[model samples]
Target: MILGWRKRRIARHAGKKNPPGNQEMELVIPNHFRCPISLELMKDPVTLSSGITYDRESIETWLEAGNFTCPVTNSMLRSFDQIPNHTLRKMIQDWCVEKQNYGVERIPTPRTPVTPIEVSEILFDVSASSLDVDQYRCLELVQKIQKWGAESERNRRCIVANGAAAVLAAAFDAFSNDSVERNVAVLEEILSALNWMFPFDVEAQKSLGSRASLGCMIWFLSSKDLSPKQDSIVALKELLACDQKLVEKLSDFEGVNEMLVEFVKKQICPTITKASIMVIFYMVSVAYSSSEKIKLAFVKMGLVSLLLEILVDSEKSICERALGVLCGLCSCKEGREEAQSNALTVPVMVKKILRVSDLATEYSISTISELCKYGRRDEGKILVEALQVGAFQKLLLVIQVGCGDKTKEKATELLKLLNPYRAGLECIESVDFKNLKRSF
Candidate 1:
């Protein structure tokens, strides 16, 4: 009887079985089986040199975040190596299996982390395969690099550190001259790999900014596939930021500015839109004399109208960038005329002032100042429109809220320009001018 009673007690303690249509009881995990960092059941348990066990991912993350010491003990690590705690992992797996009725599942075995030597071997294969001679082999190797890059941040860093970016860029430059139609698959794959390897090393960036690479990017931008186009624009944005020389070369590409402006006009996606705008901004903002040519090209392409449209209903960040580009474009006579011709220009500029941000306000006021200051035939009309759009009131708000000295100076100048027209317009009430503490 005592033996039977002991068996009953063991069954009762294991878990209480629920009746039909009832919720299952929660499983209680042992504290020792939990990782200290994640406070959850350990999947792939690993031991540090400090004698503490943690989940492999958790420990890797801790170290990756620049924490050299042990998380729980706060002691300096003697070695960076993490030894697998296979024994503990097995125990956790068994426990999970036993709790299968309670919705617990066993963790799959973790894959081995990629090492630098493995990345180097693949890169060597890539360099060996010629796109013209061994197209199949080249595609496979580039795809493998892309796969490894997608697996983990560690893998990406390892791949990049081993100079995968420069190798892939060189491969891309070599294949760039080929007909993109026949080799679209290989070219797209190469672009995908290169795109994944963003924040490239300076050498890699320079290679990307080469003439062949720039031409290749333009072709991708005009491609039917949205994915490659998105990737290409993002890559272009990064390249333009790193290399000023790329600006001049980029303008030389046929229909490049038109493609960039079309991307903005279509509003393909916010990421692509912002990147396209920034590329245009960089192209025109170059200190070199080619910038003037690029600016005129963009203005001829109706960029001012596109920007005015964007300012109508964009978010704060887009507004700021668009306004910045507008400011640059307005520095030239054609850009000022284009902006002045757009019915939305003065009203949008007024709406943006003191509303979006300090920078937006500054750009808005600066663009208006350019039109009013340098515009050929419609200077008075622009000032009158500024007055009509409640720009006068917004300028006062800008001065009252306080802004940078430059912005304030621009606002004061605009006030002086619009002050004469304020009394003539019906929109300007005496109360609007009552708050002024100083003359414009």
Candidate 2:
């Protein structure tokens, strides 16, 4: 996706000639004349299934990004058949000709979109038995076709119709143990193509869930090699998200938790970190209730501390997932104890309340609620520690500014419970602090 953006950016710059010189130089293209997707003058204009029209390349890029609806109308695109707006194309061309002295370039006609027969032939070659040595070429063709599908939902459905996903999965299984570095690179491309398909074609992931394929995933993640690691994370996240049963089966694999922990702690790529956090959250959240050791296994691997580190600078998504894992861990006796025991746990948790997002707010409030409500081992110390972190201030504000009914209720209850300890706090101007003031 990033590469596509980079290509488009270069094309845009390459398309533009130098700015128009001072002919009252409002050198800007008029808004009505612009491509909605690219904001450039329309070239080879084409109308989508919706009534709106855009430059051919711009609209195709949107579709390739896996967008299903018309970017303008949000209408579900009925087909990838982007009909050429011949009238608009001529008008754009005429305008460019009129502005030739102003440095405008003539728009060229776009090539036709890839046909189904072409995609079919590629799929047939992949499925054919003629040459095992030519697997790399076949994989490259699949990647291009998947990318073409990204151009529009119509093209994507075409690729799927031609069995692009099944072929990619088969390729992964075929190359699972090929120790040749070149083969590993091919597997990475195949994995990435699968990642792009995940949002649309989930059944394709079943091929990747096999023991042999999973073993390769772990090997890539654990190995020091950096290039394929991000794709590995994306593939793993999709696989885990699609199959809850897979979550249960993961306990049999060794070092999976530890490997994901290293990814988060290393803070390699934001996407990598986010993906790793989600897989960890799914594993612990889905599996820990049935097994005692799974939740504690996270604690043993320094999961609590690692999550705290992620919370320090990570974005809202990462924050939400980290809190989720903490929630699962805190459900247990040791899990709760480990969270409160961490120095940053209470301070950061309290600070997060209304800060990142509403979801983050929910998990933040829930975490503190666990500490205050279930701080059974050291209830007094837990409440005091929370109070010291300005939990009383934040909770009162939660009630004042308000949140979802569930979150507000939890906050109100915690505030009422801690009311006896509130005295110098300024935000608690309400009656909730009356009892706590007397105690102080």
Candidate 3:
């Protein structure tokens, strides 16, 4: 009787006609054979505790996204465990085989999902392996973690939840002072693993913020290879954002500022460039007293010129941060002098005004104001440069369009400074005429 029923079902599928000019026939799949979550033929049908059957992969993804309720039923789930619906699976497979000539392919049995316990064991293997004694094994374990993370979002989250990030951080911290040549491959793998598991948990962040870890990152910043350098800067940026105290300590590290300046000069990639700029900004914009020292150190490294160069064609976020760092550096005497000496300073600042963002506009105006107020030589020339670069008109636009009170105040002051220089310049004639009409 079962064979007869199967043969009749196959004949029914075979009788379906192909649409005109089409080479293949569309199979009419049964509604009950499809997963509620995916609306597709269920390859590995699993019944949830809520009595809902779905494709295992689809439901797992749904649950991973923080939804605990049954998607279709809208009922609370008593358990996350999904029981395999063997009868439904057998039916779906039989249907697909019957419609094989109509472009339907049988689904292969899905592999078992990775468990948290399995991820924990991998992390344990990574922790037990030592780069100094067993570099090959260490690299292998770290690479396995990286491979798992790359396979699926669920696996990455699983690895991270099992403390992969913290383990890699501790490994990096432990070998931070070792020679780069001896542990370069292992270190790079560890960095790759950590990069894959970003937005590190609190424990991971704390581990990455240790003194040895900071030193390790500084060493990577100086590496001849670009990948590790990029990874290191990104990690450092995250650490600084999480732990404000690291900013102060990082500033005290000798040659760190110089390395960061060099990294910006290289401009390997936008992500790395932004990270390096932000790290520098944090170091130079800490507490006021120490900030001055940090600013001086960066200015001495020719950060002023570097910032101006960055401002020329940088994207919005990079431009804002570069301008911010410039503003901080300009607060010190040496920084202001360094900025004023750069030929691009006034024109770049002027061009940036009212162009990138409100914050960028404010920083540009503020930096130019500092130059005009404190420039030992050619304050008039700086004003003249401002006039020539359409600074006067942009500043006027900034005021008319409205901005924060501090920005508006700076614009007003800048306008007053540039007013005397606007006499013969053609750009200001309209403003002067408007003023004359108002006075009358």
For all candidates in order, the CA lDDT equals 0.81, 0.73, 0.79
Q: What is the Cα-based TM-score of model 1?
A: 0.84
Backbone clashes in model 2: 5
Which window of ten consecutive residues has the lowest lDDT sum in model 3?
1-10
lDDT of 1 at 60: 86
Cα deviation at 30, candidate 2, in Å, is 12
Clashing pairs in 1: none
Highest lDDT: which candidate? 1
Q: Which stretches of candidate 3 lie over 4 Å from their true place?
A: 1-46, 55-68, 83-112, 124-138, 177-183, 288-290, 376-378, 399-402, 426-440
Ranking by TM-score: 1, 3, 2
TM-score comparison, 1 vs 3, better candidate: 1
| Candidate 3 structure quality by residue, lDDT tens digits, 227-283 | 888899988888887776788878767888778887789887888889999998888
Model 1 lowest lDDT segment of ten: 1-10
Candidate 1 lDDT over residue span 59-154, tens digit each: 988998999999999999999988988888888888777766555678877666688889889888887875453567889988887777777777
- Stronger candidate by lDDT (1 vs 3): 1
lDDT of 1 at 115: 85
TM-score of each: 0.84, 0.73, 0.77
- Scanning candidate 2 in windows of ten residues, the lowest lDDT window is 1-10
Q: What does candidate 2's lDDT look like per residue over 1-440, in tens digits? A: 11111112222446654444521343556675788888777766888778798987788779888999988888898997789888888887887777665556787765566677988887777656213745567667766766786766656666777667776776676677444255676676677776666652454567677776787777778757676788888787888887867776666788887888888888888888888988888877784344558788888888888788778877778888898888777877788888888888877887777677778878888888888788867766766767776788767666666578999889988888777765653232243233232211
